[model samples]
Target: MKNVLIISGHPDLQNSIANKTILDEVATALPNAKIRKLDELYPNFNIDVASEQAELLNADVIVWQFPLSWYSMPALMKKWLDDVFLHGFSHGSTAKLGGKKLIVSFTTGAPAVAYQHDAVMKHTVDEFCYQFETTAILCGLDLQPIVYTNGVSYSARQTAEQIAGQKDLAKEHAKRLITAIQAA
Candidate 1:
């Protein structure tokens, strides 16, 4: 089994009913994987840079799960990257993160329609996540297509429908990530 590391970065996890459910499914499907909630791990926002870097370096597949905040990651999570993913460690000719597979699983407060180029949100999820994708590339990692779901406050029926929609996307993406890691 792959040594998958799932890092969940939601700021308000207690109210994250839907994303948590998806994570549960992912954990069930990938039983041997290691799941870490960053918020829970570094509650005081004092991330151990070396430890986090080591985890990333050791992981065969790294999944970034979070709620989209201002079109990017949560503040502390962004700081986590800034602190741990250093120049020589995560992005250099011999970066430690090279050759690993990176996958982003995200949820948003706005509706899916709002994330369209012609809509108010003004960009597709892929477009919004470009910074992370490019960073993965700089680290020589494979940046898989993102899995995005919208409307965090959706009703029960809506949440189920949205999750079903997201499940297909997540399943396919997860397969690619696992296959890439295995092939490596």
Candidate 2:
């Protein structure tokens, strides 16, 4: 069995509903997969570079799960990338992380309609995923089709029914993500 490493980039997963549900479902589905919760692991923003690199090296598949922040990954996850994916390790020289499968999975606050060409955001989520594509290419990782769930925001949803509905959506999102990971 190939080792699967799931990196949870949600800054504070405990405070989340959709994201937390997604991760919980994923963990249950892929029992052997290592899900690293960034918030719990590094609350002070000081990342253990060596440990993170070691996790990367041991994985055949890497899944990045987070709530989309400013059209990109959260600040903590970004810092992790900066501090861990260094030259001679991830990109240059040894290229230790080469050939690993990378899955970018995230949830967004906005609805699907808002991501269209003529919508409020003015571009699709895939367009915003260019940075992830670049990262995959630079690291020599095989990037998979992204798993994105739209309109799962708690702020946009205010009722008990709405929250429950989003939770159900999150479960479906997890199933879709699991299928994608299995295929990859």
Candidate 3:
């Protein structure tokens, strides 16, 4: 199996139910995987470009794991991408990330039905993730099918049953992520 690198972009993992559970499940299922929690590493949003690039170079499969915020990734994740995926390293002649696989795994508060054309959100989850596809193309990285968990927080009040269900859903999502990485 290729070495997998999970770049977690949850702004506050301690308060998260879905994202944290998924990350834990992935770590347990794939013991050799390297999981990097961006919030913990760069709380000030000051990314260490050189160190991040080095991590990217060492991994064969890169997984961007986070909770969907405002239909996209959190601010720190965007900053990490902007800071670390530089012209030379990720796109230009000096690019070294080619052929590496990228998997986008996330949890969404909105249900899957909400992402449909007739739904309130009016756009599929994949449609919202087009930018990641373009980024993979530009970086010459192989794009893998996304693994996501939806309806994680659709209700404001979470009952014991609902919380348990969310945990189970997260575990399933993590399994799907593992499968995607192994395929990569």
Candidate 4:
């Protein structure tokens, strides 16, 4: 079996509905997968670079799971990347993270209609995934097709029924991600 490492980049999984549900389903589906919850580990934002690098070294499949925030990943995950993915460690000639599969799985607050060239958001989900593709290229990681779902946002103002619907969408997203991981 491949060593699957899922990095939960949600700033606060406990406060989350869609992200948390997706994670729970993934955990239940892939019991052998190693999940690293950033918020729970580093509330103070002090990332352990060595440990993270070690995890990267050990993993065959790496998944970055998070919610769409400000057109990018959560600040905590960005910090973790900056601290752990050093030039020589994640890239450059001496790097060892090449060829591992990277699957970017995320949910957007807005619906699918918003992510289009002529739509309100003015860009497609694939456009947003360019950065991940570039990262994988630079690091020599084998970038896999991204698994994403939109309109999964949840808010306190939402009705219980609406929240339940969003949770169901999150479960579907998890299943798609699991399929990608299994293929990887």
- On lDDT, the candidate that comes out on top is 2
Considering TM-score, where higher is better, how would the candidates rank from best to worst?
2, 4, 3, 1
Candidate 4 global lDDT? 0.92
Predicted structure 2: lDDT: 0.94
What would the per-residue lDDT of candidate 4 be over residues 108-163, giving only the tens digit for each residue?
Answer: 88899999999998999889888989999999999999998888765532798888
> Candidates 1 and 4: which is better by TM-score?
4
Clash count for candidate 1 is 0
- Between the candidate structures 1 and 3, which one is better when assessed by TM-score? 3
Any residue pairs clashing in model 3, and if so which?
Answer: none
lDDT of 3 by residue, 61-115 (tens): 9999998999989999999999999999999998999999999999999889999
The local distance difference test score of each candidate is: 0.75, 0.94, 0.91, 0.92
Better of 1 and 3 by lDDT: 3
Better of 1 and 2 by TM-score: 2
What TM-score would you give candidate 1 relative to the actual structure? 0.82
TM-score of each: 0.82, 0.98, 0.96, 0.97
lDDT (Cα) of model 1: 0.75
- Return the candidate ranking by lDDT, descending: 2, 4, 3, 1
Off by over 4 Å in 1: 154-184
Per-residue lDDT tens digits for candidate 1, residues 18-80, read 566666666766688787788788888999988888788779888888878888999878888
Number of clashes recorded per candidate = 0, 0, 0, 0
